[model samples]
Target: MSYKRVIRFIVFIALCVQAKQMVAQNANTRPNIIYIMSDDHAYQAISAYGYGLNHTPNIDKLAEQGVLFNRAFVTNSICGPSRAVMLTGKHSHVNGFKDNHSTFDGSQQTVAKLLHNNGYTTAVIGKWHLISDPQGFDYWNVVPGQGEYYNPDFIENGVKKRVPGYITNITTDFAINWLDSRDKSKPFFLMYQQKAPHRNWMPEEKYYHLFDSTQFPVPANYFDDYQTRTKAAHEQAMEVARDMHDAYDLKLAFDLPKDQQKGLAGNWQGIYNRLTPEEKKKWEAAYGPSIEAFKKANLSGKELAIWKYQRYMRDYLRCVQSVDDNVGRLMEYLKANGLDKNTIIIYTSDQGFYLGEHGWFDKRFMYEESFRTPLIVKWPGVTNKKIASNSMVQNLDFAETILDMAGLPIPADMQGKSFVPVLKGKKKGDVHEALYYHFYENQEHKVAKHIGVRTDRYKLIYFYENNEWEMYDLKKDKSEMKNVYNDPSYSKVKSMMQKKLMELKKQYNDPVPVVTPQI
Candidate 1:
């Protein structure tokens, strides 16, 4: 060959070899991310969080191999808004999904879309309450609305279909199936969410007998008189005694007349309608006797309230039991396939729930029970094993952290700071001086519209509709039973917190405003 031709050929071969090596290096460095989330999962329920309500061996295993964020929280402590904040790395107002009533604008930029655009494969499987078609995912199979615990319907790549079997197990099955079938050439991001342990808690047939023998003690404030608080405390309809339904929540007295079926029964009926004859047989075998015996008890007053608490705890824990079991199955799959070493696994919830705390069962208030959610992360090589961090991270920071872990540049428009450094134990102190929260949905649940800020020691809330303010010294009043906003000793503390709350509101570009009108 001529000298000139030989020189050109050599250069081309060198370029080809360099490109191949770069691709291999990228594949080796980029970790696969699997984010597992559940709806209304209270941090207190997790044994790892030390609340001691239930044992979640599989989730606890993640904490053993990684660090747990003890002070994790949500920007907006509700379902859709929380998820929206996580996706966009911004607060609800900025993301345009302010509450459950707001719809997510899919055309906007999201972490998933950003990752996909930057050469990663993305998928979201399980509960999606945003009420819009997923835009960024390469694959999506989500349960419609608040999905049924049994035989739920899922929208797979826009095709609606009901899959038989328990929803949690079924969702996990789809997740593992995706992992097995994904294009291994590129790193994958799978949002493996679950619809379990939400409202109308229904345990899998196998888990129906799980928590039956356990007698849960009622919370200390289960009979909270709302004496120290304002109208908001007394007005909410989420109290376990007043809100939990007969046929729906407790799965009792289904044989009673339709008129006698206290509260809403639609959720229960939906679960029942989906069960096959064989599944029904197994379910009845487990719960039938309990239902009959409860009717015979004719319990009342304090006895009835305590019974309801025990029943709620048992059912909630049973659902959690199934979740833990399915999580173990996912962990086993990852380990057996030798994919555990390079994967970053995360476990969190949409928001926290009330397990008879303050006699309440739902979330939305700025109380600690609904405000603080558990955040456990395990990144095989990156995370410090078994270490726990007290840094105040939020659902707002989740997107930025995921992007940073994946070695992508966080968008400037995103309002949250990446907590990857905190995860690695390189940083100290709270992520921010304070975390800001705004709850817009009001009047329906009797929860007044409010905005608040929580610091490491104290919390200050402004109930604008009622023109009331509440301040608490968290160290002393962990239950938040006392509102020290007007206390003489805390007057200075309240002023400082109030200023900080407004500063945060301005920093986030959500200035003080009038409360949203009641729906």
Candidate 2:
């Protein structure tokens, strides 16, 4: 060979080697992501949010070490649809999962798919309530639809098996096991989701009596009359006093008369039967006295309602305590394994729940309690420690933001914008001028179909089916007691918000027809 050709070949080989080294460096430097989400976990219940309803020290550690978002929300407030929005970075209408009844279209592009394609080993363990099997993950072990809190069944990579433990602990066990077994050379994206603090609030045996002695303060609007609001508010069947089942929700069926247990027998029995002999004994020992005392009190009128509220709060908070303890366990595991420094930890919920807000329990409303979700992110080096951001972000942004964090190109068709700039402290202001929300389900809870928009201070909601409108100056009416849509004093503000609402609907390509109520 010629000397000139030999020199050129040497240069080419050197360049190829340099390129391979750079690729390896980039792979190692990219942070591992652990996205932790809980079902029906209200922001008000978290100690970091300052409601002080319960103590969540472990979950609060995320806020202590990173950014706590004050105004994070969901596009849709229901379970399945909200998950779909987070996965696809699109609204329910575009994603084709508008309600609990609709199955998630797994073929569609998702952040998991994007990350998996771009060399991140992905796994999701815990509650996968989206009906269809999860796709685009190297590993997935999910419980079948609204998973049981005790001895839950997990479908691990298409194989179903009953796992013998509390759901929270079991889910964490699977996650930690996967982290141990994963390919350490590649960056990982693990969705360590939990089903604790969900409905039928069942805590692990250790936490069954956690809040039994504590007296939770009732919400100011616990007895909301819904007089000024539209028929939609009055029609909802989620009121704690009226609709919450005694046996199923409060766990009072065992000692109650058969007549009082008529409609609640099946639900309560199904949940109770899930416990083993030892677990059942422990559960009864913790709750048996309370049940007997409640019956003997012969509580009536408002007193009975108050008693029920306390019972509900105790059970619910116990479940939350379990979740917090498990969060601490997961965080310690990450730190012990040397993954903490290079991992991006995100904690959020499917959607917020009502803790007696406006006399309600289940979420489906575009109201503040259900519409807003908790978002706490701990990005090792980028996010500021012990800070709070009021930036208006939604679950719709999750996919795009995750892609951006992985240094991958976001798809042009995705509807949500990446908020990585905010996390990096580059963007100081809000990412969105206005946020849009639409709830399509008119089932279970009987909350009417509604669409709304919320800006910094004002909110405008329209119950299109009833041709009703409700406006709230959230700055003044944070509790949302008064409906001032027709108030003559704020006509100008109402008009402006209405116009913004239409712009958002158009921007989001929402197909729901607008029916402006005549004043």
Candidate 3:
């Protein structure tokens, strides 16, 4: 061969080797991600939000280190649909998981599949309430259908196994184990989820008596009359005093007579049956005194209501305590493995819950307590110090934000915009001029199906089924007690909100028909 040809060949080989090294370096430097989500965790309960209900020091650390979103919300305030939105970055209707009764379509595109295809190891552990088995993950161990609190069963990679321990602790164990065993050559993403603080709150044995003596103050509107609201508020079956059951919700012993047991006696019994003899003995010992006192008090009227509220708060907060402790465990694991600096940590909930707001315990309405969730994110370089944003972000943005953080191209079909710019302080003020919400479940809580839009200072809602409209001026009526739709002085504001609501509906392709205001 000629000398000139040999020199060209050597240069080509050098260029190829340099390109390969660049690609490898880029892949290694990408940040690992840990997405931790809990079920029905209200923002008011987090001490970082300044509600003063209870202290969550470990979960609060994320807020202390990163950005705390004050106005984060969900597309739909229910479980399955909210998770579906987070996975697909689409509204419930677009994702085809509108409510808990529907099964999640596993064949569709998801953030997990996108990341997994792009050379990242992915896994999800804990509550997988989406009915179908998790798809597109290298590993998944999920609890089936709300899951048990004590000695729960988990479906690990499609195999059912009964693990003997508290559900929160067991779920954390699985997550940490996966992190330990994952292939170390590539960056990883994990969805560490928890099922605590949901309905029928059950705490671990260690926290059984944690809040037994504390007397939590009742909400000011605990006796909400629902007079100025739509009929839906008056008809919901989630009131703490009226709808909550003794055995199922309160965890009192099954001592009531068969006629007065209200068909809820068996629920607690079934959960108690899952515990071993030793565990059951400890549980009964912790709760025995309260059970006896409740029965002897013969409580009636408002006094009885107060008693029930205290019981509910204690159990619910206890469960939250376990979740916080487990979050600390995961944080320690990451720090110990030296992944803390290179990993992005996110803490949020599927959706917000109602902690005695409006005389309610569950979440379904478009009210602030149910619609707004807790969102805290810690990015090593971008958000290393404490800051906050009131940008109207939603769970819809989660998938896009995750993909953006990993330097992957977000699919065009996703309806959510990445908030990374806001997180990096490149953007200021709200990311959206208006936020849209819809709820379709009309079965359990009996909350009427409604669609609404929330702007910076106003909200407009339409109960299409009831042919009713409710408007709230959030600046003056944060609690949403008054309906200003019919007031003439705010006619222009109502009309403006209605127009914005219609625009959102059209943009999102929601098929709900528009109803003219009845004013």
> Residue by residue across 1-519, what tens digits does model 2's lDDT show?
899999999999999999877766765799899999999999998999999889999999999988899999998899899989988999999999999999999999999999999889999999889999999999999999999999989999999999888999999999999999997768999988899789889878888778878989999999999988999999999988888887788787554454554556676776777888888888888888988898899998888888878888888888899899999999999999998988999999999999998988989988999999999999998874888999999999999999999899999889999999889888878888889999999989899999999999988999989988999989999999999998999889888988888888999899899875343
Against the true structure, candidate 2 reaches a TM-score of 0.95
Candidate 3: residue pairs that collide? none
**Among these predicted structures, which one has the highest lDDT?**
3
Judged by lDDT against the true structure, how good is candidate 3?
0.91
lDDT of each: 0.87, 0.90, 0.91
What is the RMSD, in Å, between candidate 2 and the native fold over all Cα?
Answer: 2.9
Model 2 ranges with Cα > 4 A deviation: 1-24, 255-264, 516-519
Query: Model 3, range 61-165, lDDT digits (tens) per residue?
Result: 988889999999999999999999999999998999999999999999999999999989999999999999999999999999999998999999999999999
lDDT of 1 by residue, 179-221 (tens): 9998777888999999878888888777778877888878889
TM-scores for every predicted model:
0.95, 0.95, 0.95
Model 1: residues with Cα > 4 Å off, grouped in runs: 1-21, 255-263, 511-519
Worst window of 10 by summed lDDT in candidate 2 = 253-262
